[model samples]
Target: MAAADREFSPASSIALTVGSALLWGVAHLATGRRRIGLTLLGSYALLVATILSMVTLVGSDLLTLAVQPGWLTALTFMLLAIAAAWTVVIVWSYVLVRPDSSHPGRRIATIVAAVLCGLVVVPTVYAARLASVSRDVVTSLFTPSSAPIIADDPWNGRPRVNFLLVGADSAPSRPGVRTDSMTVASVDVATGATTLLGLPRNLQNVPMPPGPARQRFPSGFTGEPPYTPGLLNEVFQYAEDYPEVVPGVRKGYRGPTLLKETVGGILGIRIHHYAMVDMAGFAQIIDAMGGVRITIKDPIVYGKYREGLLPSGTRKLSGEQALWYGRSRTDSDDYVRMGRQKCLLNAVAKQADPMTVLNSFESLANATKRAISTDLPQNLLPAMVELAQKIKDTRIRSLNFVPPLISTAYPDYEFIKRKVEQTLADRPVNKTATAPGSRPQSTPQQSPERPLTLDEACA
Candidate 1:
């Protein structure tokens, strides 16, 4: 009799199909197709091992080496091709082990099994595509569009690592790109404690790096004589205008290096990296997470500088509203605007949880494509991921170098260093959240070193 006409055990047929679903070739091996089964088993094992290694090895340099876009794209397609083959194997296996031709509805049973095989394969294909898209986004945004001017080392031995986060403004009215908002995130490598220092755009006489620029501005950067004194924000654009000052900066990434060095000189510390976001593109990021909730302190106007868009209230603002709220300076000064930016930062830090990110991944990917740019290497991602989780419980402290605390015209660099040092050292041991319904001790003292609470600052 033919194989289809031969008497077959119902249990064995069911087991073969189900077994293939679980291990791709388990049923083949169980049914004594040892050579075919072993080949499949080896392939399955290799794929599983590679995936497990990538996910488990985050926060390590090893993770970076493996997850490059090229590798991920190749792996993604390979898995999909395997899934297609597996679907074929499942259907073929059932054909080989079918019940006798005399069995009732034999054709119907075969069709049902084939349908089931397609169901499993469809989702596997979809998942592979999603992973491919995610890898593409990371590679496009962070793979370094230009050769980086600076090099990075492990912060393992250092007490702290500092990063410059600049909000780049390239308004149509402006001559060139200006760093409208500049902040430094000095983080504790071991503890994950972070200190944020906001620098106002109007800050004057900001120091230059130790180069011809510094020698020229022995009294600090004051632009050129005909132009009069310039503000801190202009430092980057100024250096770009005259690259001769900081000779040998990377061909395309001149602004980041120049700005990073200027801030480092002003604060008197080694800045490890800089990540810049275009202000116009900032709206996309906020919109990706479906806009952010903020406490609107005052009416904010834009463009014509008329017609208020956001009235004072606690409400959810779209990307445009949030950007204006952060950028508005007509009703107030740059210092107050800087305070609002800090409040916005704290709100994002507390609200943008993991679930939100996972659900809105594609939207976030689009936003990142439009708004974000960073010098951070892909290899450092896994390590940063590990560090982020470790410090999830720690409170982030804010310190702005805005007015009343220190003169912007002539900042006390020594005092600024001391505050950064103090925040890093005297940081609360149990900075984690207190138990439910239990009020923590309140501090009667407040200084730039310990900025106002988010609510107070926004108010």
Candidate 2:
């Protein structure tokens, strides 16, 4: 056929085919395949409309759906389906508009179209993989409570929800898990304000709430034989060893259940949930986040004979360094280390921004799965994530029952309760106005009357 009689020039056909990889169906319409072209266009428009409508209607509840393993699995398959459909469209479009003659240009156009198809599939496949990983993580890490506080409300319509963060120290050399670090994170459901109450590991005479354990230790914890004089941290191993004392507790939750009751009794508040991380696994988590940045006021010494040293100054520390920063007690008492741990928590929370999380999500997820255990129901994750976003920038208030204010050997339980009540009652403070890279203004010297923010404690 004469050039004028043909539908399009070779170059024009090539352009149309390439453009179709992006515009879907345009090549078909340009090549007189009107029926197929209109169908593809209509399908694309409908998909867009449906997505927009879902977003508009669902709003924040979309996150609620995200936490469901079933939904996530479905999402992975759906993403794959979409990728397949789109790839088919790209190839079909190229077939419809490719240059008619057997020429080098036609071969080149074929190669270009293949590359474009790959570009479209690669990212979607990656997204599908992420969705699959998320499903596995949710299933393995979170156990949905058979009995939630409320059927509809994740926070159970409470003003505040308290979670006990326990850093458990369990080694082959040790008999059972030890609650090395215990902090209660009480969060205001509405405002996302939080108060962290840190309890020293060596806290003695910890009162237990009314229960079987309470019945046994009516006069507060005072270490049983083998475990030695009862310290606050010993409660975990004690509970683990004597499961009959805390009967009816979940299989793996006996220790946490008893510890929760004990801590709640001490704080005079109902502990809603508990999250425990192995002290060893904490390092992996830190590494996953690419390390935590902290302002070390003085050199920290760790290891037997003080072989490890974390020098003073503002430094970005690796997983091991952060572990030492929070755990070291050489020349420093537990009170000082408690302050350092609070600072470390604050720094990790502030520095692990969304981009960092996204970039290292796989490693972070893997480390998190191995390192942590929690009684927080899977259904509550969406709400927890929502709350975290709200409070990420809010200054964290802290109350450490250490030294001067209260002796670890004889903690004033009544005084501790009053301070906890006071801290929670106070409105959550905004992030301090301290200049970047400089020390935060010191909190009025730790008095019985005042609590410290992370900034103040760290400073």
Candidate 3:
């Protein structure tokens, strides 16, 4: 039979129909006499057959009705067939697991089963509708004529571009909640050089923007604004104190823009784009990918009274564990946590199967829509997917800004100004321009130790 006709194939339909009928017949037979329910069984068999056929064939047709003008219709039908087959398996499992005895519990079980079946169908149907709506919304949001600067120059002269990626623990209208975590990713598209810069939540004072200066205070200070001039760690605590005053505080931190500007100044690179992913969305995407594997370089033990344990070795982590791994910093310092973040990212990158991700695109897209906010254009999605396909896990390199590289120096205003100046000055200079302090040094023997002290590290 042709593929389209296969959806309506009588043999398959009859088998499934009969199977369902036999189950219902057995239920009725257990209640009373078998002979009395023969007619009921026959009627049920016919009803099931008709319903199955209509739902499988007609439902598939209706979904793919406006898929496209050509071969896409067939592809849509095939996808629908797959979805229906899975749904059938789920429903069949429910039918078989149900008890045959006609007790009050059985009645309740039957009602529960029916409700569950409806619940399953409802989401699938709703997801399909949501998918359709999201497709249109995405299409409208991303116009082909207009593209982002990153898309235009994926391999520009700049070796690295910093992106401040934030996960706000709370929304603006609500306060007291602070950002769960803050990450700055520096991407060098040309060489596939990527680094995940993780900032500590409790480091001490980090400067706050001018907006609601009154509300933002350091962690320890009461009545004083939370804003302090110290480490990136203290920012969240300050934001928490007077959450109402800050306009865009998520959790206690201000918006992603603040972090972006802060990191950009430190790194000496202009932030090309910013992407924000919420905790819930992060979990969904990780689960969809069947979890990720990370090789832990150091043993970590920490909890209430330091009870949690993760030995040093390769371990496959579930979404729940991964979240804890990402968020927890009590055992290790912020620098080590930054390493963990990069490790998690690398693990995800290594295990990410394109076909699997493509299949879960609907779920992924839906999850992203609710939890993520990015300045990057939506139109670049297809291109990004294609680029990801071409790049191997080994080709991607992860870096962290720590120790001697980027610091959290005090005299906050002066440090920020100097960092920004250094970044602007550290542009991709032409090889021919032999300027002092710009050219590569001669040898390791002649080079001086460039260790960044705690003061420099903070700067």
Candidate 4:
């Protein structure tokens, strides 16, 4: 009998080959592609081993980001595409090894292979579409501007990176934007320790350092009111309205640049970057996460001057309610609201674990993108991702130059600088909340400026 005739039918070959695809190389070995089969099997085995090892190493850090709605959405789509391509490649290789078969099953076998390939291709195309849509949403969310970036100094080699976080509130009806929340985050490069330095919006008489801005103000950015006009947050619009006042203000980023410089000088630390978000957008982000469920310690009012009151206890809050919860200055002061904001943050982080992000991926991504704007470049995203791993592992210490700590009215810049230095150097008193799950103390009842554990605050 001929060799071809001696071999089993095409059905047996197709069946066995299909089985080997699971192991990714068994089918090829059974069908006389020994060299290629072994090569694939070995390569796949090595890849699997390497991936397993990497997972073990990265571990919780991977979990931290993977659950994040923004990160997971992108990852899900990418994974689907890879899976689809891989399936097609495997099937094509199997087709090449099929035994010669004039048997009736040959056509059936070809049809089956085509069907399998189609299944993968369809999902791959769908995933690609989803990923593209998401990318568009993220790109469109922020109002792009020339960052007040110092040329050739990207903090690549620094032991620390600091950035200004501004909560910019601007409405169509309003003429100018107001920065309601302003906090500077200084991150330690080596250990991922983070220090949050909060600046009150009503701060006065901030000495403007020698720059293009000094020529105009000479002494400082004197607000229109001449005294209080130069509040920390007010400087943004001041710089924007009168861009010509600051000599070297970047074409479109005058306002942000000015604020960065003023904040940097006051804090006695160089502010390398800035990130801003609309308070309304922040509410949208909360709503997108399906409303953060939390134990509201007290009945908090919203909509300016006790316009509304959110009841206490464990309940879910809509975007508007959450926004009010964070920004409500009706019954409470700015510093008190700052504490509420921290509590909201802890609630969101605790509730929106990975599975939750996946479930609400679309809404969360849209809300966050619409709300957030930052000068931090896209190129640095990978680096940030790496740093986030370390950051999650390290304890985050916070210091707010609010209340008795530093007088916002008179304001001791010297004491503020020394405090910042000591905090960055790692203060023993502030050295708590040293876990990924831990949060900076900011409960409605507890002092917002101090670091209090969630348990302590809740208790």
Candidate 5:
């Protein structure tokens, strides 16, 4: 039989059918009179238990892969399963073969079992390490962690609303880290009318609550003293100084709460919920989703940044490339970057079809566990999923707070306050305000524009 064919056979049967089985038989006959050692038998049982666990994991993973069928994703699942099996086998074998008071023939059986275990383990471990690292890289680059927040609000007379998700990149390896993306999704329970608002990271001069001032030194300037209160971003730097508040992470803007409060103050609407995720989780989620397809109409090139280069135009983005797409500020200003971020988000939503997502529920669950932090309760998943299922792909709206309507040149603090005021008052938006240098005037033409495809807008 071919090696491949043999490997697929039942493990117990394989042990009995192969050349190794014949060898075992010969050894058994040679030691026929001797009983197996207690230590050896105990070790063998432990080894068996480990093998059983590995088999269970493999079976579970296989079932998961069947639901979510992507070649790369399936391969990753298999590799991890095999590696887990191998690790257990190695530990089992070591325990089984250790020197002990036993008959010489029993000792020989222990040795043989150890050798067999090693045969299965060594290669699996090596392969697993490589696969895991590669998968991690893919995840780190593509997936943005989104924490789901669900709440019933009497104020809005609605059952569900999603928060604008934000995650500060505070990893030491990252420099000049800032809020990478912001998105607000509001859903009406009765009509299921959903509006997704994508806010630019650099909308400038958003209204923030009055707080003590703090300055942010550029990343890696350990000696530079923190700044005092002035802008909202300054508060972020000040928050970092309070170790009790932020904890663990060193590079994040300290004032996430302040930022949230400021956003709420500006929008003039109470934000019912919030979620924060970092770049690492972001990439993982993307990879888990088998990458996202985005049409990039503009020729975007990041001149130089730690995030690296990206050539624009419709392209299939890996995790790393997607990160660059979201974080690219050099090619365009912050407002434009916000648009790109929305585009990426839309692409992710489009790609995450319910059937596909359901099939990869295990992977999605794993990714969610690793990357997301949310106030959303586990019990709400069924309702959320049901709501999401009803959402037609075409009906989803992506909104951006941009120039002509909202200027980036103004401090974000002021801009956000105006935005909140407008939102709370249920005022009509001036779409023409998006045009550069155009004053936002109240007019009948102020209805928001339909979703702009990348071809029309990005180009």
Candidate 6:
């Protein structure tokens, strides 16, 4: 009898069928179904060509596609289509190679083929789900804004773009949000060199920009009765309480918008975008990223009774430990914590590898969506992703407005702005003064006239 028409044992039939299905068309040719085998091969070739064309058009960096919602949505549909085609091929392969009815183990081979089809379906479904989740997160977080746009220049020809990053101490248990940590990440549009301008949360009398907010806090942001000693951190809560004072600002976003304007006014630059993440949910994100390694200079005592302690030295901390490392204030002061916060930020940025992110993406996505809010326009994401890639390799500098540099109690706004300008103009240093891999030995006591790179500040 011809090999193609011969009845094989169930074991042989199963092996040949499943293996050929994986190879896309080899099983059909083995079973005298050359027509179907060739068709599948041709279809697969076309699919590959279409995918290659897409990659060519989208640019070589596939990771950048994740940030583009429109492209991601299309990718989701394509993934489903590919999965469906694979299923059809697998089924066809099974039908072509199933043992004859007289074969005792025919039932077993049929059951195995169904299982193989299911195996093919599983991972593709998971991938499609991940794509869908990514799309939703991007769409929700970066809603299209009615903000004005420049036709020719996406960045409006700005040399640098500033983003206000806020760590908000707010939860359902808390009445209002406090800006626990605020840093302005200023990035050079062309080079991706970054300057992290850290602001003290307790900065008193922060000047408001010229508008309704400025009109209300004309003599600087002193508090209304019962909320005296108004600090910069309370700006958000204050804005929330009196929405009329921030007319034209969106209702749910008045606080962040006001904070943005206030921060911009303080720094003497326009804050292009703002993103805030809840302090309470901060640990979740760190956990999702599989925790972070930080160089702690000294033992930190935290909690109500100094019950918690994080020992010093280079250590990989869990999410909760990292949170306390950056937020603890029992023996540590805010200024010291602020420096730690900068170190923590730098560590997370540098250590979060693409493989880790991809492996923990689902958990990371959920945690991020629940914890963060931003006013960054959706249309800007692709450009932002490109900039981020640049930042990974570029120099990063940090300057915090703390005691000795500028008093939080009574800051010289003009001096601060001049310092900002000088730091921005300062050329990159060729060598770092600190030892390689050394943590910030002392709280960043940056010179009033000199700029401090992040590597030097928190090496």
Could you arrange the candidates by TM-score from highest to lowest?
Answer: 2, 6, 1, 4, 5, 3
TM-scores, all models, native as reference: 0.77, 0.89, 0.50, 0.71, 0.51, 0.89
Q: Model 6 off-target regions past 4 Å?
A: 1-6, 9-12, 56-59, 101-115, 146-153, 171-174, 427-449
Q: After superposition, how far is residue 417 of candidate 1 from its true place, in Å?
A: 3.5
**84-121 per-residue lDDT for model 2 (tens digits):** 98899888877766776656577777787788889979
Over 1-459, each residue of candidate 4 has an lDDT whose tens digit, in order, gives 532234545676567556655566776666566787798788768757876986899775664443334664766666675676468556755566455566676777677666666666676666565565555554454333344433244355789999898888876876688887888878887778777677877776677767667776775556787334567777888888886766665754887788888899888899988988788988888877888886777788877556688998888999899888877777668887766665676677678877787677777777777787776664354456666677767655556667655556566566567667766775533322222222232331222245444344443
Model 1 global lDDT (CA atoms, 0 to 1): 0.71
RMSD of each: 8.1, 6.6, 13.2, 8.3, 12.1, 5.9
Error of 2 at 40 (Å): 0.4
TM-score of 4: 0.71
- Candidate numbers sorted by lDDT from highest down: 6, 2, 1, 4, 5, 3
Quality of model 4 by C-alpha lDDT: 0.68
Candidate 2 vs candidate 5, lDDT winner: 2
Cα lDDT listed for each candidate? 0.71, 0.80, 0.49, 0.68, 0.51, 0.81
Judging by lDDT against the true structure, name the best candidate.
6
- In the range 1-459, model 5's lDDT, one tens digit per residue, is 532222221333233322222222222222231243343344446756876886787653433222222433555566667545544544433333333345344455455555666666666655454345434533432333254434453224555465657755555664443555666666655555566666655544344444432122221112223532233333344455554434454444345555565555555555655666666667677887888787766666642444355555677887767776776667477777777776776678778876766556557656766666554433344344445555643355555666545554443333344544444334754432233333444432355444444334444
How many residue pairs of model 2 clash at the backbone? Answer: 2
Q: Least lDDT summed over 10 consecutive residues: which range in candidate 5?
A: 213-222
Query: What does candidate 4 score in Cα RMSD to the true structure?
Result: 8.3
lDDT of 3 at 114: 57
Model 1, 318-359: lDDT tens per residue?
A: 878788888888868888887777787677766788777767
lDDT of 3 by residue, 27-82 (tens): 33433435634654675567569759867876634333332223233434444554
